[model samples]
Target: MTAKQRVIRVSTEQPTYAVTVLGTEISIDVNGFIPRGATSFDVRGTSGLRVYVIYNPKLVTKPIGAVRWPLNSEVEVIVASNDPSSVVNDNKVRVSYYGPTGETLIANAWLYLTCMAISLDADTSRTGVVESTANNKTKWTWGPHGEGAILLVNCDRDGPSSGNLDNAYPSVRSYEDLQDMSLMILSTQGPAGVFDSHKLLLHISMFDAGKVRVFHVNGNTSLSSYEHVLGSDKLSYAVKRSDGKARHSFFVEGLAFPDADFAGLVSLNATLLEQPSQDLPATPVFTDTVVFRVAPWLMTPNTLKPVEMFVCSIVRGQNTNQKFLEAIKILAKEANCKLTICPEVENRGDRWIQDEMEFGYVEAPHKSFPVVFDSPRNRGLKEFPFKMILGPDFGYVTREPKNGRISSLDSFGNLDISPPVTVKGKEYPLGRILIGSSFPGSGTRRMAKVVRDFLYAQKVQSPVELYSDWLTVGHVDEFLTFVPAPDRKGFRLLLASPLACLKLFKEKQKEGYGGAALFEGLGRVGRITLDEILADEYLRSDSRYVQSCIDWNRNILKRELGLSERDIVDIPQLFTLEHSSATALFPDMVNMLVLGKRLGIPKPFGPIIHGRCCLEEEVCRLLEPLGLTCTFIDDFFSYHVLSGEVHCGTNVCREPFSFHWWNILP
Candidate 1:
């Protein structure tokens, strides 16, 4: 019989037998050897050993001491030892059977035992909860009962000299890169000679070997002491105990993300192998497994604090935004945020920086960093994210369509996220992702399938699609945005409302401002009075249709983000239909740059009433109550005339959420 067998059979003919007991339970079968007509039995063992006689397995509770063994039951044995056995078979357990008469002895058997302790552990309990004992370490689940270690993708560039993500290269570049990996420990305690005769192999499945890499940390604090042990090229590694230390630690780093074909969960095992003879093959005596789930990429919302702002400089073309750039520089200083200006030579006249990429992040218990998600628009600013933004501690990831087909809807401006919310008693701690697409079943225009699949696979922020194909540019930012608020959900959903603008104009006409002209003091554009604007029947009908489109998305936001009417702020705006698609009648006010308490809005140049532009006055009145400052910026000729506005021309990288993504129940 091998030492790995759980059941030890004993008879009167063979009473003495040696068995190696690890940190697991062993059952001793005494059914065949016990005499007939015996009513009960007694089990006795050494001080460090625990012995239990189970009469009825169904009724078995945690026995306090040696219990009576009736017919058709078994004996369970456990050995607890802090040190290894100094002598061979030093521990013993005896089982005595008695007949119906209490004084009569029927039969008895003795079992000799040798104990050893071995375990492999990781953060398999609560995130910060660590323990050395081997309990629930193999299986991994989700929710409140979830238990497993979390692994980061290690996609950040930790070494400035390396010019690539740390995961791309197998060799360690710096100590900071090592900090991004998860920790695993192997512990063994027993007679040294037993380990010499046995082999300990650290192995991973061929499927998982490519997903993770393990490194052995020798008993020193130097770069050369770390050795790469197992990864894509190697499936199993023989663990060396030459240092004579009872404990060893290994660092594990994830190389790939959880894609469509991969489930994100990986397991590694440490097995103790034993060879019975020279001619026999080695067999596994005990195996301890620890599981890890790769972390997902997450998006940040505008409500978060802005760490940096990105804008492109245009100085060559007739559509140069020199004045808008100056305005943004002052706003950046007011917000105390760092400003990064992409020169004209690098941008190649593509001023739409916001459409090129979106800022997000990836996190693990060990390390976290901001990751820029490049869109597949492939415009003039396509290389900006990878060449300029990706550097030390910054990551870059992108998804391109297989057929190389893309539309204006693939731009990053069509992407957005809401602040955290609770819907129908379910809390989305990371909020929800919002994407713009055609109406259901329209199948006209949509974001690329590869990009959508990648966002859905994140599992934290469940994405909600809204209809934006009605717009010529086809971006969600043109009609909707979010701003920080002092009350009510910690933020407010800002939606462009053509109906609100029409009502404001009619109220102005009633108050004897009917002759107030829009585009005042502007030479390039013609001035139109409020009375004339209200008289245009086609314009009124187009504004009604635009209201319906905004209303559709408003209702969706209410349901998906658990928002109400009070949580939404409507900004006065109008749209004119051209070729059956809507375009902003004036500079779109909702498409504005949000910097903490300050907002840089596109000046609508609406009719001036009593020495104040009614459009600017209306926006200030709605937002100022929530402790916000609005600055009207003139992007009329440079941006608005070109079919974009303030938000489309700029991008912001905000701080990540305080809550860890791993804690979410996905």
Candidate 2:
């Protein structure tokens, strides 16, 4: 009756906690306290010891309280109190066992704590593959998202421990883009019953902060696919045996980093570990501090960070341009990493005022008024991809606007605009935009870029000057929305109400917009999602796009709201087909695709074109019906930003296409 067992956790229902411990055949009641099927005990495991481990998409921590064991927990322990009077309080239960000449088995993970002779043993099991159950949560949700659960593991030993000796999976940043994975183990030892008191956690940040997913692998199963991604050179062939009886030693296994720019991956599951209660950090380590492995950066370069700054031009006494020089000096004093405010304006006086309007920067007594953050330190999404340019096919193109010039990017290091100058002798391109002090949203946010590009789309003669001089307002989408390029009257109507032109708003609800609602209201077209606008025959079509749409809706809408698979698949009943969101880029992704069929959707041309250019799928479909075969423009995303140094890549602000691509920045 004195034997140890290691089991794989299948499920944890109270009373009969089913686990195949150590490849042994045995079932135990949770302290034999509760009846079977009465309640369910959630299971979870731990990760590495790092300060940031808690918030990681992969690791987890303490689960269900009572780290050692619940008061009535059906844990079988052997208490050997040599002093006889040792109190066996709620936290003082130890597993009974013999040393040197005999062996003992402790079923409850916390059984070895009350030990006088100590060391409740368990039958060790062969290592199994550990995979993340929460990896799926990392899929793009088109918006912010996250997922997580509680997990628990029982420590079947005494006051001594070592790493998660078992093999585990490496943490993942964006699993979809991961080319390869690695694993690493850590070595540590502490009180035997420490593990049961700790739990595991994992988290995932999806596609550019669009969504977030989380998961917890409880018990033994939680350890898969959560190994340390150590350098390949770190793996060594070694083994250790404990007292000839335990035959197990602790070690750290290192995995590999597949992505180039990503410094490493943090497996929230394998790394969110807590030292058993016997050993706790005086300064609690948070889920975010933990570091694990390196991988190809799925988002931005690990080393890529732009020196954030604000560009401002002071206009004093109605002679604003005079203050431009002083403003540059002020900016240069505050900023580091090399950019100076040296705007190349054909007309100095005009340039001074021009700079002011380049950005959405509106000078006022309140420097912080109606502004996002105080300065560059708090500006920009900090996640824009500017190190490289996204071309028509999502290709990473260097900013080679000039023959040999470099480019300036945002805080996240994504190239924002051509650096306004070019290198003549260097082998690489160094084209970049020269920033003016007067512009607003220059710290890194794209507000200025959005505004400038919108104006430029209007075929503006130096859109920057137009804004600073003419005081033009309203984004291109909002301005030209009701005014078609062919209609002169409509265009004038827009100019009259620069703020929220009649094209974009109604005087009744006239105080600007609610972002998306404004776009839809002025957009004129009905929302595809809100109206269930797709043809019924779409599902019955031969293409799998129909199914793809269903699947997308399920994930984008259903799983987000915890809807059933059936309800999610039934698109008609789920969302408002008329809402503008229904036809956003991702939905357009579904429109071209047919579902259920084994074959994929037969896109007429390349959806690449559909995406590259800001053409919505329904819009693209409309063109075909209208017999207008215009090219798709993938370059839109990259050219979406306001470029003070040059004209916008695509004139989305001016003509027919301006409304569709308004206020967008690459």
Candidate 3:
């Protein structure tokens, strides 16, 4: 049944995936995932582009052990849009953390943008010379069009001697000579560290024609704010001549890092004249690294950077990129810390990658694109560290799967498919009572709690094993780690992690909703004609759009999937396309569709979620990308979501290398 439409990751779905077509690297989703959203499947230039999906959920109310998907991991999809005709090519396509779950399509996948073929495709031929400025004079120079951002760190190699200041610019030796200084820097944006040489060398310099004063250059006002950057010189000297000076000679002081080496980061500077009187000529300029004394300090990642969720965006100012990086390095004499004084500037927009692209990174000199730090638990570093360091696309790790290994990223190993409670031993696929709430909110916890309550309602007479993903919660992990194995089993209850929500989101985004659809589509081809669930709220942000999805698919699955073989209808193998909890009407009704069946009604997109956008007010909702997996006490079936295990992946403790809860929750 033509179920091969380009699927986009809509929820906490794994947007990043690796494929063999591109050979080891992950082929990002170029075609958009929004169902009925985009008009056409534009797959013309599939040669060299890196694309993927990005799933950002607003709330993480699931517990650990319940799900193991990394909060923001990139999973490779099986199908490649470029080929469009092949499922498994001659070469085996492998991805690090993706498992097959019978259900094939993931829901709400966005077509994330990656690198382009080339920003400035060079022709190689020399272009006509253009009048470019050199030595403050416009001169004809020849070159190509390709220009990359030349990031120079330590260009300032201590200021030149006063004598060297005589000849600056093209032949200038001193740093005190420059016509103009511009910077297009994207820094942490808050309080940044800068190095103003004049103020730094105040104590060492002998002559004080004009004492150096460091300031935070404001991008908006073009003014500098001074809040004690350095130099407790304690005294200053006015120039010998104030208003009526033949010319004042100012020593171009140098700046330095007392600790960090020149390898990682460096410094550079330029020079300007003492208030040039009507009589005084302008100062010479030099374009070289600023060389100051060997004052340095170590900048650990833990320090300098504030401990927070993540960097939203570096606001670009109107007239200066310099405002972002120009910070005065105020090295503390006693300790290793430095108070970076930052000046205010204009707010730039947050740029993002195009559709299906994770951590939006485009190639071009075009101005005004959105950007966010996207260092959630620093997973981006290991997965997608830009091509040069690790190559542009996500590096897919293909491991030889254990023979007959049924577990993919979303599957439970050697799991039982039927529900716990016995309905005359009929063996139902989903559990007895579905304690469900739409979205990954208290829903998971609510499900756990209600499931427990439901079990208790019959006082354990249901005579079945209770399964839920809560076993993976950090709370359970804690006991699983330190507590002896004999003491691990009946651990009572659990507390879920915030990051656990990420796992759930990933499951839905990667395979949950789509997997469910696949179940209804591929299974009971002739018998069951309809499958619908209330999951509109679980959608990342567009809860409303999710509803539309339900309506469209309800009819599609009924008419489409109702034409499978008789084997599927009589004895359906539900290894794929079915979840542990929630509603289970899909398979029950699948029987009616097989004998060329139909569910009477033309549409069945009923039971939409009933919540607003969970991811809209992200900051207020505290949707921080912490490795945090929630933890809580595990009751027979009751549970709670917590904050301790929120930092899920960072913790190296091996208490939780297991996933029994997936069987219950799958």
| Model 1 residue pairs with clashes | none
* Tens-digit lDDT string for candidate 1 (162-280): 37778887777789888788888888765555654567889999999999999888869686777889899989998875423378888888887766667789999998887646688
Best by TM-score: 1
lDDT of 1 at 397: 86
lDDT of each: 0.83, 0.21, 0.20
For model 1, the stretches where C-alpha displacement exceeds 4 angstroms are 1-5, 8-22, 30-44, 57-90, 93-112, 125-130, 139-146, 242-245
Clashes of each: 0, 166, 117
Tell me each candidate's TM-score: 0.89, 0.20, 0.16
Candidate 1 Cα deviation (angstroms), residue 278: 5.6
Q: Return the lDDT, model 3, position 117.
A: 9
RMSD of 3: 35.3
Considering TM-score, which of the candidate structures 2 and 3 is the better prediction for this target?
2
| Candidate 3: regions farther than 4 A off | 1-372, 377-383, 386-528, 531-666
Q: After aligning candidate 1 to the native by TM-score, how far in Å is the CA of 388 from where it should be?
A: 1.9
lDDT of 2 by residue, 341-403 (tens): 323231222221112212111110111001111112122211111211111111111111223
